[model samples]
Target: MQKRSVILAYILWLFLGQLGIHRFYTGRTGSGIIQLILGAAGWATTGILIGWFPLFVLWIWLVIDIFLIPGMCRNPE
Candidate 1:
């Protein structure tokens, strides 16, 4: 497998973390999918107003991932 880089991870986190692309890059595919679904659902449900909740959750998750990225890049479990 190609090695992961902290730089690339941060870049993806900055640009695509909303979809959990950074998590996928870090080999955390399971949680990545959760983020993916949450992001999609959050956006999709906006018309109903209930989407704010998921979007809020996703935002918090993204913020938390900012700190977790380095460890994920290093260990990648």
Candidate 2:
């Protein structure tokens, strides 16, 4: 059982978090897919002005993740 790295988790969370890449790295595949869809929709619809809602939700989730990353790195299950 390899341990996940807090630093790497944080890095992914910072760079690719909105798409839930960090979650995927921590083995949270279901949430990762949901976040991926939300992020994709946010980017794809931003131009037409329908994406802001999901983006806002994702932004809040990412903020919450700031503290969650450490636990995620530890468990990753």
Question: For candidate 2, lDDT tens digit of each residue in 1-77?
Answer: 46799999899998999889999999889989999999999999999999999999999989998998898888878
TM of each candidate vs. truth: 0.93, 0.94
Task: Let me know the TM-score candidate 1 reaches against the reference structure.
Answer: 0.93
What's the residue-level lDDT of 25 in candidate 2? 92
lDDT of 1 by residue, 1-77 (tens): 55689999999999998899999999999999999999999999999999999999999989998898888888877
The TM-score, computed over Cα atoms with residue i paired to residue i, of candidate 2 is 0.94
How far off is residue 64 in model 2, in Å?
Answer: 0.4
What lDDT, from 0 to 1, does candidate 2 have? Answer: 0.91
Candidate 2, residue 10: the lDDT equals: 91
Taken over the whole model, the C-alpha lDDT of each candidate is 0.92, 0.91
Q: Single out the weakest 10-residue window by summed lDDT for candidate 1.
A: 68-77
TM-score top scorer: 2
On lDDT, the leading prediction is 1
